[model samples]
Target: MTGSPVTTENVDPLAGVRAPGDPACDVYLTGTVFLDIIFTGLDSAPVRGTESWARGMGSSPGGVANMATALARLGLRTSLAAAFGDDKYGEYCWETLERGEGIDLSLSRTVPGWHSPVTVSMAYEGERTMVSHGHEAPVSEALPGPPPARSCVASLRAGAPQEWIAAAARAGSRVFADTGWDDTGAWDLAALPDLAHCEAFLPNAAEAMRYTRTDNPRAAARALTEIVPLAVVTMGAEGAYAADGRTGETAEVPAILVEALDTTGAGDVFVAGFVTGTLAGWPLGDRLALAGLTAALSVQEFGGSLSAPGWDEVAAWWRRVRDLTPADGRLAASLDRYGFLSGLLPEPAHPWPRRRAVPTLGFRALP
Candidate 1:
């Protein structure tokens, strides 16, 4: 069944806006959960009717799983509201996300006799193509109660449940909505009105341009500011463009340079970082830069959820460059760009516990 259309009278995203206050959980993510089988390091896609070889292969939970794991690793208390089948894949995802990543899944459900979603991701350098299949439990069945979070992450798609966004907004939860690829290319403007309840509307460059009917990412982001308070257009490799209607300002951040092996789940990781920074009260530029850095770090490793860097990794990277004395001007400028990380990292005197790589990896680092 289709959800009720969003109207201006019903949604005032700013009406609920207040100073950041303590909440039971940091983020509440609602979406599909897919068991992903990722193949990494392919020189190129397979020819039609031919096979291609991959240097590495790994399995991890996909979809919202990527964002959940990323948020947990960044030290956010995240809760997921989604459906999982009562199958082994579903069990694997549950245990991995909850036990391995420290994400709370109490709101998520395990449906009986339903097949969980699964996807096969083909990774080629910084790009990926995926073939997915599965059954998604209705949103009503997945999250029957009001959201218990300070913020929420949802997807903008056809037939999405608009009521959830409305409920979150009514409860003073900041809503962040991300768009997916629309194969129909309709770029449905009808979806824009639904974002009235969202504090931030995030979409990739192509989606932003197509949705706003603009010629470029900047123009698209500016156009989107008319509908939502903050509009972020993520331009892969080119970084992201952000326009804040509340501030009447626009900022663009360049992407971090890294050796990308697989781009699977990079977008989700970026969202995680962006949301984390937003809740932390950072400036828009710092948020975009951190998001870009998070995405860059994710591409450096294999797997989807498994590849997300934890606080330890981020701190380690910051420690490696904090005292660098670059000899060249351009190198110095590049290092200066990352100076924000130094402030964001945890205190050197107090080490935060790291998430386990897997259930059997053991939690402690070797002495």
Candidate 2:
């Protein structure tokens, strides 16, 4: 809320190729949204029986909202389908997505008498511990079908198949999926039946290795391509490696070095970046670079959804890196790697509203 007047004038990454009759939305997704309360500036995790005080705190919509906000801020026309509780928290989340981020929530509905899901996250020593509480919304509240869009991002859970994924694929929406950790410890790929329709699968190094039974992340990425057309394995500090099954192309990009403050939803931000690049049809290496850069930026801030950077932030980061004097080999290499962004970034104008995590939700009325 502390920036220039919030404006929706963002550079459309896909402007040059857009044709008439194209889907109005660039991405479509559906999942639960949680009210995330984050506590930062902690030196270490709290001990039992001790009253701990965090130096900073912030609140924002989380869960699926994290990915939704990231996509919208990147100038993708994002549409979300999810259930909201008829409560103050729900109202705040709804308004933030629709008005603050310009996300289309027409497919979302509110359930009467239901309280919103909430998560309390404590970030310390570059990691986070979270405790969440909420009951599952009734299945009857699920979206009837996926809307036509250029692409859809989905979280694939083992043993639970989302029917809309196949329907969306059949309707010509490219599907990109990421899986949650299998608490059952099975890590069986067959459990994710919806993956058969996905155009790409993105997973962390451990998840990729466990699912493919490979000792190396790159090997896991290769093995994963047997199932999906594209496989991206995020190697954390090492960056990401991608394998395109159809074209037999492979690319690896190193992660950007940044002093991370909180990593609440950095993975979701990474996926949003990849989705933007994929829909815009960038090269595989450029897609991986953009994804890593966006995630690197998100960790420097607090909360999940609000910490997401808009095109302005991306442009600013590009300019900052390009201006460094006496550049070393590493800096020069980075400049060369990200040079593709020069043509895509919008010219600097009134910076897009750069939202940050604030301690309180209540603001005094302006005179």
Candidate 3:
């Protein structure tokens, strides 16, 4: 089903702190965007030679677009710099982000000959497998530099550092980084030179443990603080934990229980939530809670960018739980933990219609 356009009446979490010279953008990021086609409701992964039919499917912008859309949905002014191919897929993704999600693409460019990258993701039994294809854009298409912003979120690669990360940090932007899997099996902390400039480093349980040589994810978080001021380790179902090297503070929040439909881009949503709370100067525990809450909400839907919840969803969730009688001690504890959202949420209003990814890129208009 088609969804309504995102409402522009979002409550800015940073309204109270704005000043004349503050950056126009709240977050800046540079990366690649992909046209993601996701299939769900599968009983098992695709067999080697057997045909499998999925009960559900959707299409939307993926990769860096996932994070950008997440931030924008949360009311942050997000800026993305990337290369989009001059193809139908590219056109669709551009409009989806620039108009649909209200993300700024001033630093992005359209390559004449390149085609948009594509990924086919299949979800089954709470796990997903993906296959992707695309040619790299020419080095000449790289972003000239990052714009001034309150913060930047970057996906860090082990040995290949983006000069823009350092540039953004030098421009007084607080950088938060998350890393992909280490394909080379090095897991060497020294390989990530860009971590030196980051204000925070977020990695999953496996990545953190491997990089820090620690047996426990929490220990890995503490070990990483020696490299960055703040380290957050995300344990999928267990929730997330954080350690602050500077303040000697730590916080852990349990994951909100939900049946996940598709896990695509859930991690990106988590980072976006954490960045939102940090920019708003919320407490450490509050930041972790917001991150986990947003991620939890995203997994209950399909696709990535489109599944990210806006302020209206957060408010709806708060109201729902508060109005319900505590069915269990866990439910009551969750309410108490997220109580801070009562003041931060916008005034009650009609909930915005949720957006979902579509199976097709185009449809005919009624005559």
- For residues 118-169, could you state the per-residue lDDT of candidate 3 as single tens digits? 9999999999999999999988776768888999999999889888899999
Tell me the tens digit of each residue's lDDT in model 2 across 267-294. 9999999999999889999999999989
Candidate 1, residue 134: Cα displacement in angstroms equals 1.1
- Positional deviation of residue 92's Cα in model 2 after best superposition, in angstroms: 0.5
lDDT ranking, high to low: 3, 2, 1
Model 3's C-alpha root-mean-square deviation from the true structure amounts to: 3.8
TM-score of every model versus the real structure: 0.85, 0.95, 0.95
- Error (Å) of candidate 3 at residue 248 is 0.5
- Give Cα distance to truth, residue 325, candidate 3, Å: 1.0
lDDT per model vs. reference: 0.77, 0.90, 0.90
Better of 1 and 2 by lDDT: 2
List candidate 1 segments past 4 Å from native. Answer: 1-21, 48-51, 138-142, 328-331, 346-367
Tens digit of lDDT per residue, candidate 1, span 1-367?
9976433112212222334556768788777889888887789887899888877778888888988898887777788887887898898888888887788888888888788898988888577889999865754564665456888988877545567778888888899989788877678867455687899988999988988888999999999898889999998878899999998988899887778877777888889889988887778988897788778778887767977876566665556555456753333455666776654455332232233223221235679
Model 3 — which ten-residue stretch has the worst lDDT?
Answer: 346-355
1 versus 3: better lDDT goes to? 3
